[model samples]
Target: MAIIKLSAIERRRLSAFATCLVLSVFAWLFTALSSQQKYKVKLLAVFKNSPQKRAFHSLQPDSIYATVQGTGWKMLFSRMNGDDNKISIDLSALENKNYVVLSTQLKQINAKRDIERQVVSIDPDTLYFDLSNRLIKRVPVRLVTALNYQQQFAQSDAINIKPSYVTISGPADVLAKITYWQTDSLILNNLNESFNARVNLHPPAEGNLTVLPKSVTVKIPVDEFTEKTMQIPVKLIHNRNFYDVKIFPQKVKVTFTTSLKDYPDINEDDFEAVADLDQWLQGYRVLTVRLTHMPSYSKIVKIEPMNVDFIVKK
Candidate 1:
């Protein structure tokens, strides 16, 4: 490529041309923006001063459509400043009434914002609301968690949740069927050490429901694990007192995994297996062996035999 160097006079002339182009663009922008026009905008409207003693209330429409008349610059500036784009309505004076918000109220909202813009029109000139009696009840908070521990690591203590209960207030019909408030599902993966974390509560999917203390703290205690084995006697369950029943190989070896801190405390008594003789009475030759009980902090890993021979003795 060949380079053509410009003389000082030529460079000055080029600079002057670029400056004029910028000035012309600015002049046109100023003229266009100085003109006044009407603009339709959506504004978020918040409810305040809800009716007294009414604990549960819902607004029909939480937003509004208002037309503003102002210079393009003023409108542009106003849109950039979202703080001035909000409207508030007071409902404290409502007396168990369904309200129809009129355009007059919307005009007042525009004036309150003092946006230096004329209120032209408000679409959907009306809004509605339904207010009802409020009822409060205490409900249990259930923890939803998917916890996975690394191999040979286990939870040492019970999963702990602070503030295990939550108070909910809503319409009576909505609260009647709610037995408990459950937290949003939480997941902890590859957890090998004890830790604490905060989780949020689940909001009601619908209706005017309010849940207090929308979060809870979870503390989990994790520790190393060890393998343990025990022999538990199999109990025979039946109503045949007139006949002698026998389940050969009555004792079973139960292998389980438990935290090292808790392994020593576990015993055969902590586990239970049952071979229901009722199955034999029902005309089946064999009986199924099932683990009916086990230590809470332990997990059963293996059973010696899953089935037992059911023989009736004379």
Candidate 2:
């Protein structure tokens, strides 16, 4: 390949032409972007200033909408860049004024200095709130959780919720009516062991109330289970004068369900069967034997010979 070098005069002319092109582009851009245009942007509203003697029980229209106008470039950049384009407007100027912030009152907002755009209008044209005295009260906390255990397993104890009682603070009318606080619902499946976890408290349905200790601890005790059988001695009640009361098969077979963790601590002594001697003395030789006592967390499944035969001596 062959190459040729330009003369010094030609090079200077080419450089001058390049400079002119760059200058022309800048001039065109400045004129195009400087032209008057309209654009919209949102401004945040924070209303903390209220009359010294008044309090708020509720606030309506929690957000403020601002329709603004500005240059094309400014609007494009602001709307595209700050995804959170939020400009807070001071609203303390509106206190104890019949619970409202009118569209014309929007002028009291401090956004004029921050938002370079001119606000053309405000959405809703008005804000609303409920005013009343604040209050505090104590309420009980309730646990909300669903659990499923693996085969041959079950709960070893009752579900335990810490800080059973919580103190709630809010509007007097609201707190006075709330007697209990509920926890957020949770699900634990295929549980084969004890577990401890913290859960959030469910928020009140009304927007005017506040709850203390937003979360709570939950203790779920789980363990494997086993089936067991035992012979429970039956006793005859009433008819003190009569003695030597004979009940066929003096013991009743009691089958029960219990967790393996408490299996070792259980025995036949923990159960009992009883019959009414008065029934026998009343010309009823045959009577039904009842299983009256059982250990904690133990469920009776089947009792052999629900009815028993008996003979008595007067």
What's the count of clashing pairs in each model shown? 0, 0
Tens digits of lDDT, candidate 1, 3-98: 999999999999999999999999999998899889988877666665545654455556677788888888888878764566666655455656
Worst 10 residues of 2 by lDDT: 46-55
| TM-scores vs. true structure, each candidate | 0.70, 0.63
Top candidate on lDDT is 1
**Residue pairs clashing, model 1:** none
RMSD of each: 5.8, 10.2
Given candidate 2, what's the lDDT at residue 98?
46
Pairs in steric clash, model 2: none
Against the hidden true structure, what lDDT does model 2 obtain? Answer: 0.72
Model 1, CA-based lDDT: 0.78
* Per-residue alpha-carbon lDDT of candidate 2 for residues 141-232, written as tens digits (9 for 90 to 100): 98877878888878889878888888776567666667788899888899888989899999765544556788888888888888898888
